[model samples]
Target: MKKLFTIFVAAAAISAAAHATTAFTDAKDAVDYRQSAFTMIRHNTGDIGEMLQGKVPFDAKRVQQRTDALAALAPLPWPAFSTPGTESGGGDAKPEIWADFKDFTAKADKFQLDAKALQTAAQSGDQAKIKAAFAAFRGNCKACHDKYKAD
Candidate 1:
């Protein structure tokens, strides 16, 4: 029992140390992770948009799959605005993030709603409905990026 307790304590200390070291210390690291996630969502969303616009042939199965993927990406955790001496991948995040956190969160929630609506429209297979919802989805993207995202 004594030996087992000692081994457990050592393992716990190592795990804690690793976790502390892996925590993001700078805005850049956080932003990098966010950008990677965004890229994945963007790729999937763009594919859906193309199908919706009829620029690409519509594939219900593909649309459903991509829509599900994009919808899954909603409600990203808003990142901290700035850390001393930390750059956010040349990000255009204004200081307003901290100053206007409530507004930022609201927009994030709106994005989730818009994404869900788009997914529903795509699944419904109504061309007109998909077009309208896709436009709304695109508008939400622009609005959020305009206000919150860095250039």
Candidate 2:
């Protein structure tokens, strides 16, 4: 029974790894995955921005919802960027993304950290704190886009 359980666990681990790899099976698949993630991030962040700018009412529940969504979406695209041929997948992602991979990763880390901070602030139900956190998060986004994304 012990041996059988070990084999089952090994198989489950392998299947999980395979599932992760299968997410970016080809260049186009990688690009599409990344683009879709970014699209979702943009939509969620846009709603947050609208609330921040007074274009929409500041609802604690909605702010939490949007920021939580952004936190979840933030890390999904980076792995897709690792697929070969994704550097020039007819997207606005600059080639420097790969050439300066370390810097890109650092920027991505900053963005993720800020995103989490925003999420935490939103969870506190404090509008001013959320606004401050969002401003910091937006700076991270703009810094990365300015360096890595093409117009």
Which candidate has the highest lDDT of all? 2
Q: Which ten residues in a row have the lowest lDDT in candidate 1?
A: 80-89
lDDT score of residue 59 within candidate 2: 82
Per-residue lDDT of candidate 1, residues 20-131 (tens digit): 5331555565666556667887898889888877799988888878878878877543443334433434556666666787887788778788889988988898878877
Per-model CA lDDT versus the true structure = 0.72, 0.87
Q: What C-alpha lDDT, on a 0 to 100 scale, does residue 68 get in candidate 2?
A: 85
On residues 1-151, what C-alpha lDDT tens digit does candidate 2 reach at each position? 9999999999999999877765375777788788899899989988999988999887889998998899899888898888888876777889989989999999888889999999999999988899899899888778988889998
Q: Return the top candidate by TM-score.
A: 2
Cα deviation of 5, candidate 1, in Å? 20
